[model samples]
Target: MRGCLLDAGYTPDGVRALLGRSAHDALTRGEPEPAARASRDGDELGTLVRLFLLEDTEPEPAVTAALGDLDPLLAGRILRRTPEGIRAALDVRPYGEGPGDDGEPGADWWVVSDLDSPASRQDREHVTGVGGASLSLAAATVRRPVGSLLDLGTGCGVQALHGSRHAVNVVATDVLPRALALARLSCGLSGVDVDLREGPWFAPVEGERFDQIVSNPPFVPGPERVDYVYRDSGLAGDAALASLLGGLADRLNPGGIAQLLGSWLHVRGEDWPDRVRSWLPDGVDAWVLQREVVDPAMHVGTWQRDAGLVPSSPAARGQAAAWLDWMAAERVEGVGFGFLMLRRTDSTPTVVVEDLPGELGEGLAREMTGWLDRIDWLRAHERDADLLGATLLIAPETVLESASSVDPDGGWSELSTTVRRWGGPGWEHPVDGPAAALLAGCRGHLPLSELVALLSYAHDVPADALVAAALPAVREFVRHGLLLPVDGWPHPVAHRVAAADPAGPVG
Candidate 1:
């Protein structure tokens, strides 16, 4: 099957090129007519695309010619014969790995899952293929080589496939036998060996610890009932996500990392960040980024449409009202979706919860791994005196911008100065004149303590007072990768000198 698919040029890039941009994009939006028109040529690639992707019926002769004998597929229920022709009973789509760390090309593979259409969406146990959430989790996952990796709730085995490239051993678990069956097929077709287990959460791997874990669980928030097993956890209002997070620390080896995508509620008169922070166990460092928040109505409508319900239909409207009412009773103001990265550590935990500025972009795996390394560096030098004695260098992608306004005397006056990063999370920090000067001088030439003393002497301020004010800000800069430590910890990547003037005034 793999050879036949590859020889026919039925990979992701090939399909996109054959369908053209407009037809391919339309297929993504659930409008299949354009693709149907584009793939009606009855060739090998077109027959496979129409049969598996579009869920269209093709003549038995064409099916046999493209995929050989159909008896096995028929007996396995992977295809069904009708009065007119034969149609696929499942969805088989091409998938490709993203570029490696060295920017080299990656191999192509195939994934199998339940067919995606209005008819299949009604099934409560439906397993979905690669999606936005899955892709985001894949991109944000730290891809360093590890001894073992766990893919919790591994629907269709997408994360497991990616993990197989880096980890020596990969284990995937899911509660639904249906999902497990499809995931097994995905791994087999991709030619990767993954231990497939049928259990919920971490039950299948009891007492086992992994160096890294990645999950995109059933994290949608709604009433305490389950409508779709792929999105609903059968637990009340984000409790499933909370429970999963609370148990991660126990399953990780020392210095291990775990990444997940989840959703949480914003209740009235409650702090969301604090609520999320309470879920972590001791001896774990965590970084939580909330990407977007939406009100109850929008949330209800979105999930309803996802379930293949039209907003104007009676069934959708009735369900929406009930869902909204339940949310009102629960006092849910909104729902926030985002990513969580956790690491097991022996030192005091460093937990940071903030609103992410923008979308997760390419190269995020490198950025996330670098962030964890920076956290380790900061944890080792917890004492103020220890940090002050170390030399620090400015990150290569840092940019300094200043705003100015006309003064009362007609001369320009500087309003505020801000330093921003072009890479990683794209964090921006506001700085005053003295702080800006201190950052400009961080070129790995002098220790931070010396720089602080010199600035205090130049400005005639008390050195102790300056140190007290600058230490916190300096830690923040280091944590966000705006400043890089030079001596004690080895930097994750080599530094290049930025073209922008570090100390020059901005227009």
Candidate 2:
């Protein structure tokens, strides 16, 4: 079956080239007319695309010619014979990436899941294929080689397929047996080996730990009711995500990392970061990035549309009212969705939660790893004296930008100065003139203590006062990759730094 699909040019790139960019983009938005027109030709690729992707029927002879011996697919209920012709009962889409020019390998495989459409809504157990959340988790996941990995709530096994390329062993779990069956089929089709388990949450993996775990769990915020198995956990509010976060420490080996996509409630008069931080367990470090937040109405509308409910329809309106009422009663002002990266650490847990809205480009895995490494480096030099004695260097991609305006006297005046990173997370930090000058001297040549002393002598300010104010900002810069320690710029080798100069502590 895989060979036949490949021979018929059914890969991701091939399909995009065949459908043309405009039609392919339309097909992704769930509009099939353009794809229907593009795949009108009676070729093998067209037959498969029409039969599977466009949800259109094909003549029996064409189906047979495109896929030899339809008996297996028919028996498996992947296809059905009708009076008009044969129609696809399932969705088998090509999914993968080719090796990159930088010598990084890639994956080439297919994903199998139940057919999806508003016109043909399935039951709660319906499994979905590769989606936005799935792709996001895969992209953000740390791809370093590991001995074992756990794919929690592995719907259709998309993460499991990606994990197989890096991990020596992969275990995937789902609460629904139906989901597990489809996940098994996905692995089989991809020619990858994954241990498929059936149970809810951590039940299937009890008493076991993994080097890494990745999940795009059912994180939709709603009442304690399950309308769809793929998006509902029957847990009130965002408790499903909370439960997952609380149990992560025990399931991860030392230094193990877990990356997940989740949604959390934003209550009135409450900080969202604090609400999420309360869910973390001890002996674990976490970094939460809130990508987006939506009001109650938008949240309800989005999920309702996902469930194939027309916004103007009576049923959708009724459900939306109930969902909104529940949110109002619970005091949920909005819902925030983002990525969570947690690590099992032996030392004190460090949690950084913030709103980072924008495009997170490629190499996210590398950037995330770098962030954690920086955290370790910062934790080592916690004291002011220790950090000041350490040499620092600015990141290569860091840039400084300033804005100026013409004053009434026809003279230019600087308005604001900001330091930003060009790649990875693209974080921006606003800085004052003195702080900017301090960063400019971080060329991996001298200790931060000396830099502060020199700046104090030049400005004629107390060195102690300068050191006191600059240490906090320096830590922030290092934490966010704007500044790097000379000894451990790229990776940390030791936690402790040398003592401050004997002349006297700058502060």
TM, every model = 0.92, 0.91
Give the runs in model 1 whose Cα sits over 4 Å from its true position: 20-23, 31-42, 103-105, 403-415, 491-507
- Each model's backbone clash number: 0, 0
lDDT for 469 in candidate 2 is 81
Collision count of model 1: 0
1-507: candidate 1 lDDT, tens digit per residue: 777788778888778878888988888877889988888773888999899888889999998888888998898777899999999998888886755645545767688888878778878998988877777787778877789999999999988988887899999999999999999988988799999999988999999999999999999998888899999999989999999999999999999999999999999999999989988778899999898999999999988888878989998889899999999999999999998999999988899998887545563666677778788888787899999998999987889998999999998999988998885577989998789889999998899999999999998889999999999999999988889999776653463211111110000
Local distance difference test, per candidate? 0.85, 0.84
Error of 2 at 222 (Å): 1.4
For model 2, residues 156-274, the per-residue Cα lDDT tens digits are: 98889888877899999999898898888778877999999999999999999999999989999999999999999999999999999999999999999999999999999999999
Extract clashing residue pairs from model 2.
Answer: none
The superposed Cα distance between candidate 2 and the true structure at residue 411, in angstroms, equals: 5.0
lDDT of 1 at 33: 91
Q: Which ten residues in a row have the lowest lDDT in candidate 2?
A: 498-507
Worst 10 residues of 1 by lDDT: 498-507
